[model samples]
Target chain A: MDEPPRSAPMSASVPPGGGPGRIDRRAIVDGFPLFVPAVPFGFVVGVAVVESEMPAVVGWSTSLTIFAGASQLATVTLAGVATLWAVAVAALVVNSRHVMYSAALAPTFRHQPTWFRWVAPFFLIDQVFALVALRPDGSPASFRRYYLTLGVFFYLMWLAAVSLGMVVGPAIPTGWRLDVAPAVMFTGMVVISLTRSPAVVAAVVAAAVAFLAAGLPDRLGILVGAGAGVLAGAVAEARLVNDRAITDEQEFTP
Target chain B: MNMSTAFVLTIVIALGTYLLRAVPALLLADRELPVPVQRALRNVGPAVLAALVVVSVASTADGGIEVEVAEVAALVAAGVVAWWRRNLIWSLLAGMAALWVTLVLV
Candidate 1:
């Protein structure tokens, strides 16, 4: 809540199995702000399922099986009107960004145990990635605890939020306008990501492209915007390196 | 949708998503990526988050872009609070507060 726990707590606690490791309290608390957006987003997904006239049990199963909120919304909405393959493709594309998250964390995951590697990817959603991707290097034990704690907490919370939605979604008025909640929460994420110049450039370009390409079908616009932003940020990073080299040259020549 | 159709869709989507997340994570471990690729990957989070924010804010149900002033105000309020306080709770509270106030006033 008050700036992410900057330093990992040094004291290691005994695990239930008698192994010793640090249990990160920050991981538990860090998800508080993220849940703000997740609650409304999950509710909207539940409402979509209800509105589409899908069976309640089937709708709830997607939450358990699919587990990702945005893709769950897409799958639930499309399953009613679109073909099965079409719905599958949409869900795949919508959730494909996790590939990037996986790539970014590969090095960190490399040092982790084989079982951890196999299972940890299940929790690689956007909020989890956003929190862990920027984390300072810490012990593998601590990282595992941090990742799993946050992961499980969010997973349960998501299920609860969606279930609550399924129960009450139909009664909620459309005029309540919970639509903008995710945007507000994501804007907070964007703010946190502005710590670097390349990231700033990337965010600006991605926002512009995504705004313009909002008409693209199957959420391809987000991918396009993300690609363009990454390229722009890479170029910016190269230029920064060049400028720094030039500065060093100038200083040394004097 | 029918129960069978729903189950099939869920299973298909679940497998596809898991592979997308797991394959690269498993295969790319311990591999030293090219410098440029690493640099680009580092920016992926910001790029994706920014894209998500725009799409979520602007995209309508019919896949059209619509900018609501109230929503923009809320985003600005959240961004500012997040920047100033460096805390997510305050930012969320500020943004929600701004949104409700603007919904009434505007």
Candidate 2:
């Protein structure tokens, strides 16, 4: 199958006095909005670590070092079974999306110097990918620079927020209901994902299957739900492609 | 589960999590994916995010599969803000404010 056309122009045509190949400052500015949501959610993850009876250092270090909110939350909240094996399994399940993010953006960076290409994946996150995909103008060179800057900015924000959350976790009242933070973040992601119809069907089916299977032990609902969702989405996407191909062939016939 | 032991476990967890995140990208970076694998990767983001949303909303230990009104309301409010404004800050603020109010009033 052909790749989807690049959503944005590859470059901003330079006017008489404009510099060539400069990164867009507006895209970076646009990314600031993402951090506002991320910080409170980070704080909530901090609260989860404390409430789950894990040490503050685990919460802080995991947030800083691991740097993915969902997996960190799953690790701490499920700390009853929180063996090294379980945590590794949960982290693998949650972050497997990054492989997709990296692959989607790989072609854009195929021509970049090898070092930059290697370093770039370290900063790839959902928010960074969304912003890069939405940028209106950039050459491959400019896009690479823009994406790297955006990634670093968000990465630093994540570190700072997690650090602040760790320090402030004790002071926040116990009954403050920080659990909503994860829900908010997850809802935002879901809403963004729902932009496509196949994704919506996948999400609904996955949630239904997960609810039905919630009786399974050892947090296996997550694994089952995620697996079912991916299976459903892949099937739906394949069907959609096949339908479109048939339509194109019919249109080409005399 | 003592403090020092907890700290050690946390360090282990942190290392485990990082290795999981980093290793796949490292291992798969050089390999060209098959068409089916590429298609599967494309669907992974939405599928994973969707599963996360379900788990987040429905996994409370309330002894039944009841929707937490406050959580659901907060999520809907947040979803609306995100859709309408596409601004993460505004969406979060709206969601948090709704949740806080629901918590207070209910």
Candidate 3:
């Protein structure tokens, strides 16, 4: 893959030049830990994604649309080889991890209100989770502000990094063609993220399913594999719960 | 991958990903996540990631099983770096560097 290097001045999008401090700076600062990996990761993804089949502009938008790194990358790569449905399914499953994030933060956000509930979770990425998790219990209003500020801050950083990444790609001639820059940078970050694994059964089941379906058109094999893995893992999980119940019963009888 | 398709997918994914995040916040308030549900959800991450990796590696651009040694070597380098350093940036950097080196040297 041709790793397209981003233009250097993309950093110009960083702080001070943009005087928009709606959210608390503290919340934004809280996300600093992620800056290291995220910046480079965003840039790399942008480059790889542009290298894929998607156009520069569409590739860039995944940062906001999906807002998750790994899923965004999967979306691009899958889009390159598979159909839209395949890409969509893969993106959803990859991001299904956020279901946990949403559930974990649900209690914290429950009191906010209908509109807030609807809009707030849109910003709930891993960094936001980190910031929220670390926070000492506080008033709901303060919590909302804190979360949104960090959300905005993280959003800006991601956009900028991706935008910076685009500068390295083609078609951006550096004369303030805003669309070109934004599109290219977003493309830079499309490569995406994964960090963990499961037991032998889930892996084995999923691989088998994917392999079996590998011949299906539009790369639908992975969807079948993902479904099977989930099914198998669910069975495993339920079985473990059952075994635990049996053990408890035996102990009580003794 | 027409421009319109890319645009549509981007919009759909944005909507889909957003709904995935928003629905739980709207609906799951005050309810305990059932054990089975939690377990299944937990597995979803690994299953999807694993499935993606397998399919991605196995199915080439032409939908055939062929391992590009250069890409595989880079991926291995990335996996090792990520696990060893336990840092995402370093892992990616190491992988990219390794891929570049492998491409250049061998």
lDDT of 3 by residue, A67-186 (tens): 877678788877869878878987787666466567656656656656667767888886676446546556565566667666777887887877787677354342222222211121
lDDT of 3 at A211: 69
What TM-score against the true fold does each predicted structure earn?
A: 0.90, 0.70, 0.54
DockQ by candidate, in order: 0.63, 0.37, 0.44
Residue pairs in clash, model 2? A10-A138
Query: What are the runs in model 3 whose C-alpha is more than 4 Å off?
Result: A1-22, A169-254, B30-106
User: Model 3 scores what on Cα lDDT?
Assistant: 0.61
Regions of model 1 farther than 4 Å from truth: A1-23, A246-254
lDDT per residue for candidate 2 within A189-243, as digits (tens), equals 6676576666776777777777765545444565577678767876776787787
DockQ of prediction 3: 0.44
Task: List the lowest-lDDT window of 10 residues for candidate 2 chain A.
Answer: A1-10
Candidate 3 scores a C-alpha RMSD against the true structure in Å of 10.8
Highest-lDDT candidate: 1
Query: Best by DockQ, which number?
Result: 1
Candidate 2 wrong stretches, greater than 4 Å: A1-27, A44-64, A70-113, A124-126, A129-139, A174-176, A213-220, A246-254, B1-15, B27-32, B61-66, B84-87
Better of 2 and 3 by TM-score: 2
Give the Cα error of residue A106 in candidate 2, in Å: 5.6
Every candidate's lDDT? 0.80, 0.63, 0.61
Candidate 1 vs candidate 2, TM-score winner:
1
lDDT of 3 at B30: 53
